[model samples]
Target: MGLAHVHWLLAGIDEIAAFRLVFRDDRTTDVRGTGRLVWHGRTLVWTPGGPYAHLRYTVAINRQRPPGTHFDSYATPDWIATRALHLFPEINVRFRTGVAAARARLRFRLPRGWHSATALAALPDGTYLVEEPGKRFDRPRGWLLLGRIARYRHTIAGLEVTVAVAPGSPLDVRGLFRLYGKTIPLLVGILGAPPPRLLIVSAPDPMWHGGLSGEDSFFVHGRIPIRSPDKTCSYLHELFHVWQPFHPSADGRWVSEGLAEYYSLALPYRAGRLSPQTFVRGLALFERYGRWGSDLTRTRVPAALNNSAPLVMHWLDHEIRRVTDGHRCLDDAVRSLAHEGGTLTTASFLRAINQAAGRDFTPLFRRHVYRGEPPPERAREDDAGVGH
Candidate 1:
């Protein structure tokens, strides 16, 4: 194991003024340098006066609401589900001339009979490996489920995918598994891929009735329908969060979101779970809803625009195919954004679309994205066929 040297560490948990870190220890007794510290009003600054420092702190668990719903983070006498990112703090480290890459791993010491799982790769020795490919410093990310629970795992596409559901949560884990078996393989290729490992945590009431995506994992309310009435699948929607090539600005966020939603519909259709006619109907609904939403450029728009955004993406794909004579589509455009190598912006999105289509797409984007104009209604036959 490699130690991460740090000059300082800082962290502030949310709603912490009420539940504070009342116990902590700074183990820097043998370090060199001033070993000095400074404190300001309600704020303090400190350094171990050495290259490395270790600090341990404890916070009271402000456990959440009664079961049957969902909570972001919660605790019970029997189990706990919470984000691991909050436990790791911000640290600044220094070397003589440069920075030392920090490698982090997580090992849990639990109460007797308790077991823990994380959205991290489990090593043979039982420790979880923490890694972030583009960063010089790697910290653990994802949710942690600790306690006595039902643990089920599967190897999908050779990735260890674990599903941990609190006992008696009433989640349809079997249905979830069946869905994964049917859709995961095809979606894996469509999605670029899943992370090295995947963790899914679920519980009944006392948790949010929704889904949340973490580093390589995510949480879903046990009873939330996997496939909603409108034909959108929350399962597939959140799965897209695992692999985002570039961070998108607010203006470009629609692209990222639209793609996720697009796949939610397309993945099912492509997987044969949804028929062509039904898929077409779903797209029409989105187009109608999007017609009332704001321009795609706005950071804040009518909530209805969520439907609009995906419609925009579907049409964008349609346009890409037409312009390139079926040689390219939105997938190529999307992949180009990653290849372009920067934060996704409107300009960058346009460049990608143009590059994929081998033509200028300024007019198309100008009318729909910038001006928020709805696409011209096409004859049903025109929109009938979906590309494979």
Candidate 2:
């Protein structure tokens, strides 16, 4: 096995309070140029004596754990997750270097019979490059899986998509691939293209309950039945994130998340995976849940508010269609945002809607989304089509 060398370049560090190195393992040896190391629990309080420091450490891959719902940086025997590789404190420092640009790369010492998957692009020499422009240290950008994994490959939208599952996992890999095969086309149609490569990892842990999405990859809790409606929707929701626009302001989170929820059902229905009746039933569930108490504009919208967000989106779609005389819809607005990528805010969302409909929707947004007013009642004619 090759030794893994993790490197970091530190800039503008002049004091002890400016930085600290945290590691789960305190016995980290071969440390160079990090002055006055003090061990406080699992944290290394490094008092750097220089303005710039080059830190490198050799990490050992030890015991492996079964895939679980939560994420951590520690290595497991059969599988190695990204948290295990990039979890060191030096890479995690956010206070001083939060806004600075940073780049990272990992050289894994893969044992025989082990393979790896990550969002980072792999080099010819087997090194993985992780580059972030506006360094958001707190965000978990690095996700990896190394082990005796079962990889299923498919070509969709001119992209090579690979689904990697841990060996002995209970997840139904075939079912997952089938769902992706059907759903990905619809997603690509909406977004205008596919990522060059998509990697999905399924880790089964009875303890983990939800899924998470990263840069070009995502994780699904394997405990959920593969064909279950909830699991299917959850999987689609995470997949939608890969194509969704990034919104720095928290206010526009409703737009991003609500659209994901809206399409999680709509795409399946459009793809014939869901019957019209089932799709309407799903929307009805959202409407019922949306009536529960919560405000949409709050920085942290409650889960109940999130449950109702799709209803508002549906209403917005209907309004857009009505104003445009069927020439435009919500999809156009979303596509516009996807085409013009940046920090998405409520203003940008409104602009997209106005551009698509050729009319301003500020009043409608102010009433329903911004003010947290109750969603409009379902139209009687719409219900008849849905068989309600």
Candidate 3:
């Protein structure tokens, strides 16, 4: 169980000289290759001695280190990082294989009492198929949990969702399920559909401050307080990613992250997850933070923390509502973007906004988003009836 072999098929290639096998700890194990193997830093560069269509290699697994460290490749007595160990090929390298898209399958040989939780669909033959469209064969994006884990399953909003928690985790699984039961339906009402399958993994790691979202899975730090405002916002933020896959651009980070932050609170408020006082407090907090800066177009982490981006989004939402006589809102613009598949850039977002509003929003975009002007102050009269 501590050793594994991998086989790869290369087609329409003149040379296999560019393939590199990445390993976390090369010193702990020896890799035997079918061809000449050279060590290039932490990777193994393999060059076939002759014209070959298939390559095979074996790795000796190291079980001493903790699982989920070192790029999430680990093998411990209780758990194993399945994807990292099975798919060791680095995608960033140039492979002259000329194969635009390649198919791959992984079969694991694990010890008894170990179970797996992954986004990959399992075939009838017990092999997991890796068939994510547009994903390179070398680098696959998904989660694979293998250990003596605790699993909770629930059908929410017509989607099969699974929650996997590591042993001895402090997370409140029941509370999370209840919260999701409330939140997922609201999200589906807004986005129109749920991901075919959703997987949530709660791992214990003091270093992981928040959560990370993948294609269909979410990873949250175990130390976060369960059902707290921060946890609720973080979970909804990642869930928003599942609904609308926003890619960060030079000037589009504000749209992606800001929208996520905005809806993380707004949707919950509309769904009754947050009280009026709490929701207004959240907006006030963002307003306070946003006063620190005005530039929303900068691609910096701190820029995302500024409240200006979300406030401007709030203004845009109000403007769209006002212009369309409450027939349209920001949700319409976001849904339009999701329908138009591709990387979401500032121009495309502006186009969506303009189409939704039925008028050009150039002046507003220039004054608020690109130029990062300070958000307009809320009048005292308006504040008097806050959250009503």
Q: 1-388 in candidate 2: lDDT tens per residue? A: 3234656666665422444566656435566556666667766666566767766666653323346435433345566544433435444443443344444566655779999887666789887776555664422353567787877778876767777777656777777677777888888777778766777777754314566677777777667664445313767777788756565367777777788877887777777777767776677677655643455655364454446777777788888877888788888988888888888778898899899989888888878776667666664126326644
Per-prediction tally of clashes: 12, 8, 1
TM-score of each: 0.80, 0.75, 0.78
True-structure lDDT of candidate 2 = 0.66
Stretches off by above 4 angstroms in model 1 are 1-44, 50-53, 60-70, 98-100, 188-193, 291-293, 302-305, 377-388
- On lDDT, the candidate that comes out on top is 1
lDDT for residue 249 in candidate 2, whole number 0-100: 64
Local accuracy by lDDT, each model: 0.67, 0.66, 0.66
Better-scoring candidate (TM-score), 1 or 3: 1
User: What would the per-residue lDDT of candidate 1 be over residues 138-176, giving only the tens digit for each residue?
Assistant: 666887787888888988776677889886577677777
True-vs-predicted CA distance for residue 31, candidate 2, Å = 5.4
RMSD of each: 7.4, 6.0, 4.9
Write down the worst ten-residue block by lDDT for model 2. Answer: 61-70
